[model samples]
Target: MKRLRLPIPFSIKTNMILAFLGVSLISILILNLFTIHYFSEAVKKDFFTISGEAQSRLNYHLDDYFKQIASSTSTLLKSDLNQSWLSGKRVHTSDDIDNIQMELKRYVAFNFPEIIGMFLVNREQRIISMTGNINTDSLSYRNEPWYDLPPNDSLVILPTHRTAYPYPQQNGTPVLSLLIPIYSTDDLNVTGKLVIDITFSKIHDILGKSALGKTGFFFILADDRIVYHPNQDWLGMGVGRTDLASLSFDREEQSSIQYWNGDKMLVSVKRSTITDWNIVSIVPFDEMSSGLKAARGSTFFAFMIVSVAIIAVVPLVSNIFVKPIIRLKQVMQSVARGDFSVRAVDDAGQMEFQQLGHSFNRMVEQINELLETVYELRIQEMHVRLRQKEALIQALQNQINPHLLYNSLDIIKSIAYLENVPRVEKMAKNLADVYRYTAKYAESEVTIGDELTHLSKYLEIIRVRFPHYFESHIYVNEKFHDCLIEKLTLQPLVENAVKYGIEPKGGHGAIMVSAFQDDAVLVIEIADNGPGISEERMRELNERLAFITNHVKDKQLPQESLGIASVQARLVLKYGEDYGVALHSFPGRGTVVSIRIPYRSPKIG
Candidate 1:
């Protein structure tokens, strides 16, 4: 391994002390920094987890509460006595009414303190009240507030609304209803509707008890509206101003940290399948700040103690470990300044130092020997040149086989690819045409029209490969067709566009190949609407292209980027450093790979 030659800023002893101090302090600082960072992130994750659990718990409880109401609605609909009365199958009787009220009171109303009552409305507008005396003498059942019901055949939970009758509701609280169609026992025909009303106060109470983090609260949300909030006044209000509703959250990312009204909040939500409502939790970020502050303070205190100890021990450490190294350096410096005769003689009585001194002295002796063998090296140089010439001849003889092998492989690959898809003869013909264009090595450059023809052949195969999913359009004017460009330049860039934009995603997208002249430079661009390269990937690609363009002999190409890399490299090498390819891209948006080269006037006839 080669040692980095950092310039000396002070005496060797003083540098050792400083280096030890810097390394020790930096290590401690890094450790503490990692500790603080882990602590802060762990705190954040912990809070979100707590909030998520709270939201999930709220969903469970709300589902259970709504399920209970649904169960009762089913029971009432299936009841023999009530069905007969509501369906008008039996004559009116006082005993039947008493039995119906008793059953509802015994089995349903007593269990849920929040339920005000449930009413049965038959086809004839007859009403059966569970709460007790209903003043239905002059009231039309359809005109009542609780009459806002869903489809008679479908079970639906309605949002909370105010009403007068269903009088003496639990403390003037507003009511939400669960509607289940009353089907008769015999024919499974719709008889009437069962409306089960419950108070919003109970939902608020339930939300209050299942608290989340220090400053977090759980509530019920439905389509961006608050069904029930812990604060009773905010019930049935739109929560549009809150971050919980404002951000277009990814389905995969359930928790988000965002700000609303100048306060940062952690919001998490879980949807209740039973109620079809979102159970949301929002916690102020201030709760975690104090805990993080305390943690950072503790880490800083520990770091300070470690730093003080390092300040004291660094000089003592330098004295013991750096003396022998300083002595060896003095000898090496003399050699570096052209005094090759100097050598390390003293070893400080240490075995490691003794071995090091021996190696240094041997290196000096080898340097002296190298100076004396210049005459012999000249004879070897002639032999080396003769071998290089023979190797070049052998290399030229071997180059043709690879081109032949590549041509054979291309035919086999095209046959294999065509056998799996619908288009066989057409794709085979196009693939052959593409390979034919690539086979010629006599002319390194070709006219723009010929390059587009090659690109068209490749794109047709791609269009066939991903039928109805991939498309291509060439918008370059015919005037620029005769402009000269490096062969195979446009095809590789188009392939890159297809690879990035459509192939990985298996989605419908397009590749647009366009060209225009900008003064002396001709710019050809391959643009794709497929998911694009990220910033880091784009930067790395441009850097690789630039590196290959600048250094032509460096053929160590990465497998994934062989096409675009070769295109940029060939362009820059054929022209000059002023010509190469560049990528402009945004992740999940698209990418445009542009090739810029000097415009040579239309090829002479």
Candidate 2:
């Protein structure tokens, strides 16, 4: 048996660096393989997409061009001027020709730059031609072989061809014609024809402007005749006589690849419904492979660049990954040697290193903190013993003040009683009761009966202050008297009603306190009979209450609604968003402020 082992195992930094380099190489290799394998096909797909878009554009332009000419011809066909003048058996006068020529030039040929001439020829060989301007002449066009066209009343589509009378500018250039028959009104016999001659230069611009590749171009064919070609010599050439003979128009294929002129070609076809013409787009197949040729040297260059990058990054990987661990190890060794003052680098290098450093520092700090915590227990116990003694002395000291205050109130009442001054005695007793109830911290909640009784004593005190014009009432249901509500919730509302609703009118005011049980809620209302609040002030008061109630955070209450807001805030804290206060008031009417709380009866023992 034999065993093989390295003298030293590789560290994580070395392993990580090697893994990173390996993955990088493999990814680059896979990418290069895929790129090499699919680059040519991707290029072909993009080329096909571009070619398809070009064909669609050409179809759009051609369709628009044909439609315009068709529409103009249709307009001329129905023209009363065209019918009357062309139907004449005699020659048209120059004035008649100028008038009709101007009409055709202005209405039909104005927008179309590609229209070469609009010719109206009668059966007597009288011609009215409108090109750049109007021309009136006669021609012996009947003897020409091409004159016998538009045999019936139907629209006749003439393929690109030459006219019998060849003007110098258009002598060599072929033009397409749309021949429409003119009829006489009496017998409806065809008396003349309207012919429109159009050049193919516009079609060339529409198709050639967005042509896909250098050698790619478009041509048009109508009824087995070449309607147009980039090479003008091929105009009106038959499909049987050209390189396009192989592109069969009868086939169901809209696009196909074929060999033409010793080169592979991609041909796409769109047949115009308006002109009955087929728009043919031809692009060289060899153009797609040109990028593939460029990419032949790319694969090797990419590999070399990636290999150099891997070599260059090895040291950086060691510094980022390995240096932190080594530094942390040294600090740990120092801590083991009782040097606790040494702390790891907490804000250096990579995120992982930073985390490691922070963890190391926390470990050292926690050790010292645990020691400090262990040492502080004895001192803390001494403080606890001292605090207990002081609390007992403070508790003994706290009971005397309330008792002395009650005794002083009793003495004052007794003196008032001895003097036979009833108001002073009543004021002393009522003031003591109010103070005792407020300072009483025994419970956070109290019954409605207790709260209303407290309110009555406070109202009596207010009555003493303003005995003449101020009044108060309490009308809580006996059945709802036992329901629990948050303590001190109603007092603030009453205070606000008195301050805002009653006090504002200068003393002829009354305060109404009422309560009832509605559904699951116990409601208490404090109303005042004074000059009531305006609608706007009432709305603002209610909205502030609602905002504070829902938000449940301490906010500055508006000075106008302070009392109502304070009560609502207490209710929201004691209960939740469900129970709060709302205001109901109107201008010149008394105001009513309603307080709602959950209907919780007295707890059963």
Candidate 3:
């Protein structure tokens, strides 16, 4: 599964702008939310306050209207015509009773224009002074609940009901009734009842004159029934069946918000002390908050405009801040591509940018100077290598006279053969092979097998010279025979073992040569059993080997350690610091020289 990577990576300028805008937007959003919340609460409080005030006004108006009705009823009770009729003193004949009835009707009409009709009933169950239709048979006044009320001075206000007038214009219209019980002046016994029918139009007029919002309207509830509503159809309906009935209405003057039919409404209630009725004003929440809604829209539009302005300005501001950094980056990229001639432009007005540009220019100048010095040193090293190779070829040319020495060795071998000296002839032949191998110095690298063959021939000549002084052993693996190695690498170590380790120890020592592979490297060990180097001298010799480059350049190899130092230097030059010769020795025991090099087999192609 491959990992997904972003197509366009985020840059410093973009991140900085995002951080700035994020903080700004978050802070602004929080402030706006708090402001809107507080504004909404304040508007709600104002709505409740206005509803409460409306309730107060409606209550006062209704109270005054009821008071006027009560005063009119009280005045009619004291009228002479009403008392004379009740006592039956002024009505002996029908004509006399009719005159008294007409006079009483005129006075009531003139005094109370709100009263639509008036009726009087006597103790004998006889009706008189009836200005509107009065059904004598269907009156059933005796069975009426108001008719049996215990004699009380105050007039009793009744719920609205339809009139039974025969006149089409006056019949079936709802009216409020006021019942006044007549009593004898001396005994206080109830003798008759005075009924005043007040028109429903009067109550409607009072409520219709006032309002809350567009949809706000008032209704009068009496005895849990809607006595007066703006919608005539709702009149006489039970208050318990309407949405308003679910609201709390215990107080004389109260207001609250409630949901009705899924719409929020503000309900204000005022109870009338005169009629024991409630004047409820209902206004919708949306109507009441129309202005606030408009304000909210305007605020949102302004916020949007500000947000757009911030978005447009943020990039410009971030660019202003990052421009100098961008210029420096471009210069650095140029420098990385080896174009050191380019320098960061110092056109930025800020002091920091100017200083940074100057520093970058100085650094590039120093880098260029250092590169020139390194280039010169590399050229000198190549020249020295070329001279070394030339010197090796010239030394090989000087050994070319080695063919005359070979001829002379052949002559001696011939004489030795005639004298029957087999050892001498064998010695001469081995010496000739050694000379021929040494003459091939131009070959810097050879197969380990070839080098080992030359080493065996050289060892044979040494063994003949030393007789039983030393012995040599070769334990290299055949698999590594074709592996390439530096020419004369093994021969030097073996020569050193013979001259320093064996010959000095009375020519009685053993030399062992072994080669093997360790991972990706080949290791060769040359071991000798002879008087070994002391600890102090070995330390000095290893230190000299470590600085072989300086030793080669200064021609400072010590005479006694030249062979070992030369081999260590050649191995280091051929491979690297990791491939070199290491010496391990114990005084009076033995010495071992191990060479480590990268393993390589000859390629066929």
Q: Number of clashing residue pairs in every model?
A: 1, 0, 0
lDDT accuracy of residue 195 in candidate 1: 75
lDDT of 1 at 125: 59
Per residue, candidate 2 scores C-alpha lDDT tens digits across 223-289 of 8889888878778778898877876556322555578878877666767666667777777877656
**Winning candidate number (lDDT):** 3
Model 3 error, position 87 (Å)? 5.5
Estimate, for each residue in 1-605, the C-alpha lDDT of model 3 and write its tens digit: 99998564678777776766677667767866777667656756786678667766877887787667666655666666667767776535666557656765776667767777666766665666355323345353443334455445566777766666645677666777777777766577777777677776777788888888887887778867777888776666687877656766564465566787788777767677667787777788788777767766776776677677777887888787688888899999999999999998866565887888988999999999999999999999999987885564334334322343666777888899999999999998877777777665566778889989988997898888778767899999999898988777888789888987888877788899999899999999999988999989999988877887444534534433337777776676667678878999989989999988778967831
Compute the lDDT of residue 371 as modeled in candidate 2.
Answer: 68
Off by over 4 Å in 3: 1-37, 48-51, 84-100, 121-151, 164-171, 181-183, 187-192, 213-215, 240-252, 259-264, 284-291, 316-605
TM-score of each: 0.41, 0.39, 0.44
TM-score leaderboard ranking:
3, 1, 2
Top model by TM-score, which number?
A: 3
Error of 3 at 186 (Å): 2.8
